[model samples]
Target: MSYERHFEYPLSASSRLTGSLALGDLETGQRCYREGRLSVDGGRSLPISLTHSPATERLMYGGEVECIEHLRTSLREMGVELPGSGGRWLPGPLLLGSERTRVTQAGVLDCMRSPAFEEALANRQEGEVVVLPVLREGMKYGLQEAVCDVLGAHCDEVVVDAHHVPDESVPYLGRRMELSVFKDADLTLAQREKVKVAILGDSVASGTVIIGLIEVIKQRFPNVERIELVAPLAAVYGLARIAAFGNEAVPLRAHVFESLLNALPPEYYFSPFFPEEEMHMAKRAYSNYRDWWGVDKAGKPIAETACAGYGWSEAFFNPRKQIAMIDEQLRERHGMGLAEVLGRY
Candidate 1:
């Protein structure tokens, strides 16, 4: 029996990759590549013609072609864009750059869109300083790291928000932190005992970095009991809770952190931007989770009355336990796993 198949964007444009067309029938258990206009199949010579679009990267069948359902299914499963029932093609998301760009392509495209930024990048030279005035707070460090990696040139200095803070402040902060971590002389007894990890960024990609760090910590320091992760924006609340409830209490345990874990909508897990719609959805989800948990705005677990007290930060310190708790809550409420969620990022 003969089967019909529709292909979209079937041709390869770049010489770096080779594309092939496979044809076959199931019963004969034979397959062949279309090498010429005429091919001998099942003791009969058949004429075939194939056309391709260089601009659109789409393919069109010009003559009668025979295939099998298995081949069509396999192509579809391999992420080949194929035409649907009405002969309409379904396309995937448009990626920004070539294979060489890979992870840094997004940063490159973002830079290119702004003419001023592109000009600045083009004019930059080794051992020179670059100042970024209006870059987002969370994206500054990551963007600098990515640009430096992609360009293969290092700037003597990169400054962020020079108007508000001194030029030395940002670099000093990073260097001080690095020295405190790597230099043995700078570590105090208490600091050595407590491992403090901070993921200070606003994007979901930052959150995935947090997840990967937690996994690495679990692998490298299995016995190190005290591990703290500081979320910069939420640190004030965490510290308040610690101060109010004392050292033994777990911070953001009842509602705040729980709400964060539960409020994350499925789509926002891997999305680059956190827009207003997602923010509203997250607020609603957080409220729902708080209501379900009988927690009030003040971090109190009260079913009827609103209680006033701060939450602690012990949860941030115990990463393994916190990850386990998050996984449990997500599985119980959303039927999702932490690994699955992080995989999207």
Candidate 2:
């Protein structure tokens, strides 16, 4: 028997960035730019020269893969090993970029160039899942006709098209149109009153937003017990560090080196590259470090609580490990008289 599965997901911010570039769609590109989702600065022009050719298309995809592969290989060669190896674990860049490349190579590009695909894409409502099946594998074993069975276990609610719908017993996943799902969901009065925030802003405006949020929260809810601030890919190192030290005077800069090692795996703690294994590793390392350092008399890990509300649970996620790895690689490359490797575009 043969089985077919379609892995559908919303177009991520990065994917939209690449897609806009490949399609030479200025409107999409400008939207991404205004939203601060495009990482590479095109600056008054699209970074890529718009050319319609197989080679040019391949190069566009391959360029991103090459850059990520270089970083991964360089970091590995410098002895910055990832945990639980299946060779080297896939970093976010490689995973995301390669998937997009595969999808494009699988004929999504042709669809994208068509007016039908463009119209469908443009008119797609928010929260709509875009199905992009890049590969189809053959197997003798038969399977049920359900999304969960085809895709394996997933935590999020899975919905299928009418054709793929299993049976009347299993209801279709309902779409929630509200901006805040929490508002529609059942919550206790106490839970409703709690202060939880997810902040989104550009570098220049983020600090102002944070300050403004805190002031508003304090004024609005005087008795709020816990305040949680979540900022994705924002610089929280200073905030994390301050939380770590608390009332105690910050230790010497030398301590930062050790702290940096503990924070390596989850690069999101420091940089905005989507986290992979690094986060789990960082959490484990911090737990071990806390154990070794011993807890305070309150039976909690001293300084560990500082990063409680920040992404990491222990210390500020700094780029110490990344910096250290790059420095080591550069030194090794230079000593080998292969310094030119660093300039390999």
Candidate 3:
């Protein structure tokens, strides 16, 4: 049975963090990474996204090649472009899409129409930092690629094949995080010598994986002084969980795309809700769900089916299973296939 869920993430006023974050703030440069506006109801505080970008607004609409192009082109104009060598796109959000869109190799390498070898001369930052990407999610691998693309390949990198499974038996916020995977991941002495900052790039929902990675970093890299979280989409619960670890000694900072998401209820991992304006389901795919699922109090079309992050962080890792999961949910909810739902029309 589908459990009733009301989207609400209430955090205590004193400890809740908020504010705008720049892309460069993902390093130790910005001291005040924890700053943003808060949404309050009565005496309790609510989780909110640090929004102020046209890219985030763009995401709420079309989920096509053009949408990706516009974002990349805009970023290039802002001096951040990534053109894969030999006509290849490093696996990022484009290829590692959600259940809404399947994976594809075709990229925006030709979109903005940059001069030949121009993208090769992309932004290069001389930094003593390591970009640590959690393995399995090909989407986040893009972040790892991006750091090297912009900061030069000489930037240190450590891939941690760690995993975190939530214990559903306890409260969602206070649930005991069980580390299912923690190997002896490390950086060489040369990689760690001057590397004081660690930039971790990944999509955070419940923030369990990050919590585990932090433990690994503390245990392995004691020389590291600062931690920066670069998650494009994250839940409020996850950010708050990581925020608790921030301090003057080893300050922790976070950088989200445009907004913070509600961690839902019970199991908070499936809360990267797709905005009604952003979701672009084909008529053959989910037009019926628009009617059956209807709208939510927020006017969201089919609140249940609108979550863009349906298959967690690895939608592209196992495409077959991702597609199957989407079909299964649609069938289980509407009690029929899209054809039957379309027959009425």
**What's the lDDT for candidate 1?**
0.25
Give per-residue CA lDDT, model 2, range 1-345, as digits (tens): 111111121222233111111112222221111111111122111111111223222311122233345445544564553333223322211222233334223222221233322332343232221121100110100111111232232212111111111233321211111111111134334433442211111111012223333333343333333222212122323223222222221111100000111122222232321122222212333343334323333454332222211222111122234334334433442332122222221
Per-residue lDDT over 250-283 for candidate 3, one digit per residue giving the tens place of the 0 to 100 score:
5555554433455554455656343332222122
For candidate 2, what is the TM-score?
Answer: 0.20
Which of candidates 1 and 2 is the stronger one according to TM-score? Answer: 1
| Clashes by residue pair, model 2 | 265-278, 266-278
Error of 3 at 311 (Å): 0.5
Q: Give TM per candidate.
A: 0.21, 0.20, 0.56
User: Over 4 Å off in model 3, which ranges?
Assistant: 1-61, 65-127, 138-140, 166-186, 245-249, 274-300, 303-305, 331-345
Look at candidate 3 and give me any clashing residue pairs.
Answer: 18-35, 18-36, 19-35, 19-36, 49-259, 49-260, 60-278, 61-278
Instruction: Estimate the TM-score for candidate 1.
Output: 0.21
lDDT for model 2 comes to: 0.24
- Candidate 1 segments exceeding 4 Å error: 1-101, 104-113, 130-329, 332-345
Order of quality (lDDT):
3, 1, 2
